[model samples]
Target: MWELACLRFRHLGVSVTPSRCYRRQASSHIYIWDFLTMKRLLGLLALSSLLAGCASGLIDPNGYDETGTASYYGAKHHGKKTASGEPFNQNALTAAHRRLPFGTQVKVTNLDNNRSVVVRITDRGPHTRGRLIDLSRKAAEQLRMLRSGTARVRVQALNN
Candidate 1:
């Protein structure tokens, strides 16, 4: 006949097992270990994703020039927090870009009217699809695009 014994650990229901108790006790230990390991792996994955987002938010602005449709945002988004963590002010000479780093200054030229405005990159996007850059009300006004709401424009990143 075989003898069997189980020893408890700190009252956690965990036990050291002799042969007869091996299946039950060992399986519970494996489950606990697997759960903890899975949680740790998920935590690491989340942390890496956050770090990657921060790293990829910035891109080289050198020689960045493109022609695309531009639009403006105002009143509705005023006083809201931007991606850069600043309050959006429609009256400021600022703009939102998809790739340019925050604080980058870009020259926006309205191809139709030959009007231009220099704006600091402050926010994130135009939100609407197929748009190039989103300008503040003041920037739009400077570029003479308020009435039209959108413009065919050339954006050139300044070396600052």
Candidate 2:
């Protein structure tokens, strides 16, 4: 019983001791509300940090450029509806961006092999945080990134 109580306290990021056991002694009981307040504060801090990162969220086709890791989608999502409400085609010269508008065309260059491909933005998101773009399986092949499954790429929006 004591071990279980200690484990619970530890999971909550609290230290526990025999003398601090609440059930054993009324006076030793720690107010549950104090821990609840701590939990709430910690959660708020995390949320704020997440929101702060979204300051540069959108990828603009004009004057927007960035260098980051790129990945691709394949057979598993070959025909699923994407965020833009269009069916995903793993073989098309299509890609997903975090916020670049649908129908926007961008050029993705694999930094590893210097291979490049211009792909149209057909969907929203790479889903994973910190990733800049997600290419289709066919695009990945053109960049020769199919074997490694991912590559460092420079994404640039093309002139409309």
Candidate 3:
């Protein structure tokens, strides 16, 4: 059965030398059928690892600990692309700052409500009037400022 499979693979331009294949199978407890199954399992594992990596955000550009207030941006600029080339999803637990760099984790506290939330700085902003930092919709909600839209907040840097 193994020989027949090898012959078919060879006919299809796949390289399946009998000596090499037998040697590989002999080194393990797996039979020829088991070897084929293991190969498919390994391929699936490799593909999943590649996909997991692609789903992550870019590396933080600012490179170290930094702190500032976190305000929220919404309505007028909900679907715009951020500095890291990701669409600004206001509902996500994200933030934007002028020089904090992407992926930096910050803890923002609302002075009025005494509420706080930690968020990742995933973009660059506050180019408007008097804003210190920009928070995602969810982060602002956690800070109890979604209704007001802006909060007087204290942002602290956290060490990874």
Candidate 4:
């Protein structure tokens, strides 16, 4: 049993020799804390993985211009933590784009009404297929797209 414990720890690249292994035999029950230790270890691994992905996925915003469907998220997501680690504010002029770096500002224009608003990229996505960007409630209101719920829009990244 001690050999198995040593082997398991070694599998995780941990230097656990036979002499360093702890064995507490309480009657017929032998407690192996690998389950608890692995649980916490896995959680840390997951968190680091997410951070690494976010760091690498940000793209250069220069010359980024596209026209697609735009949608807004408000009350339901207000005060929620955004991908940038800041709490979302529905009244703030902010937005989400799949690849634009956080803090990048973009101008979004509603094609139907020719209304436009400048919004900071604060979060990650629209999460819906065929969508180009996600706007905050105030941005959508300024763009005159609140009544339509969705709008055909042009998004152009601004140099900052």
Candidate 5:
């Protein structure tokens, strides 16, 4: 029984001390307990892998891939907490993304007039559904979208 127990653990890649196994009865209940424990351990490992895969910056946001209008918020909302937990900076050339990590640089091009500006993502969201991004007031000025408050644009994710 002891030899068989050692062989089973070796096959499963688990190292169990001989002293501990020798004290336990070679019963059906013990086998069930061992199977349940291995299943639980494997489940935890799989869950951890899934969480790691969900971490940010895994997806690229750059190139001529995304096109839309961009708008900015400022003055009344300046210094307010953004979705990424950072304070909004109206003067900074920063923008917001729905999923991109904070500090990602994106090139935003105004498709209507062919003007483009690179802005860093320091926050999250344009909030409104269907909107691609939210830029700071300064970024809006750079893109010349302040007059109309929004412009048709293309946003590409830049390499770090």
Candidate 6:
């Protein structure tokens, strides 16, 4: 049993000289613990730095809001090409903002009744002058503003 255990430790690269096994057991145990400690610390350090790098990609969410008129487009615009090169789908939660980047996501809040919906920016207009953002049929439905065709809204960009 002793021989087998010594051989197993050797196979694991933990040097255990046969002559010193009985005399230096405590010293060898200390050496093994020190080696393991270094390996664990290096692993922890690598993991922490990787997580920090990922955390740095996030942005502050304050000051991303815009208050203005919101509108929706349905059937005719569905299946049509959007400015983002994707086909518009009325059932999807999407929107169009004149100045927002094509793939940005914004939270559209109906200021009149305080209802809100998150929509992805997939197209580019209200083309009608005073409006701020054009939401898809589904987004409008979520905001409960389909009947008025337009609503006072607050559009806020999401950092993620």
What do the candidate models score in CA lDDT, each in turn?
Answer: 0.87, 0.84, 0.72, 0.87, 0.79, 0.83
Better of 2 and 3 by TM-score: 2
Q: Between which residue pairs do clashes occur in model 4?
A: none
Candidates 3 and 4 compared: the better one by lDDT is 4
lDDT of candidate 5 over 1-160, digit per residue (tens):
6767666766767666777667653753368568979999999999998778657434555543687768888787899997667888899889987777778888999887788889988876779877888888998998888989888888888887
In model 4, the Cα lDDT at residue 34 comes to 56
TM-score of 4: 0.72
How many backbone clashes can be found in candidate 3? 1
For model 6, the stretches where C-alpha displacement exceeds 4 angstroms are 1-62
Clashing pairs in model 6, backbone N/Cα/C closer than 3 A: none
Listed in order, each prediction's TM-score against the native is 0.74, 0.63, 0.54, 0.72, 0.60, 0.61
Colliding residue pairs in candidate 3:
71-135
- lDDT ranking of the models: 4, 1, 2, 6, 5, 3
Root-mean-square deviation of every model:
6.4, 7.5, 11.7, 7.4, 9.3, 13.7
Rank order (by TM-score, best first): 1, 4, 2, 6, 5, 3
Q: Write the per-residue lDDT of candidate 2 for residues 30-105, one digit (tens) a residue.
A: 4454666889999999999877765466555797688999999989999899877899999899999888878988
Top lDDT prediction, candidate number = 4
How well is each residue in 1-160 modelled by candidate 1, as lDDT tens digits?
1122244332446544465455566655555568668999999999999889878877899999999999999999999999899999999999999889999999999999999999999998978999999999999999988899999999999999
The 10-residue segment with the lowest total lDDT in model 3: 57-66
RMSD of 2: 7.5
**What's the residue-level lDDT of 42 in candidate 4?**
100
lDDT of model number 6: 0.83
Model 2: lDDT to the true structure: 0.84
Candidate 2, residue 121: how far the Cα is off, in Å: 0.7
Write the residue-wise lDDT of candidate 3 on 1-160 in tens digits: 4566556556657686787656654433234457678889999999999767645533344334334445688666688998878888888889887666577787788888788788887787777767878888878888888787777788776775
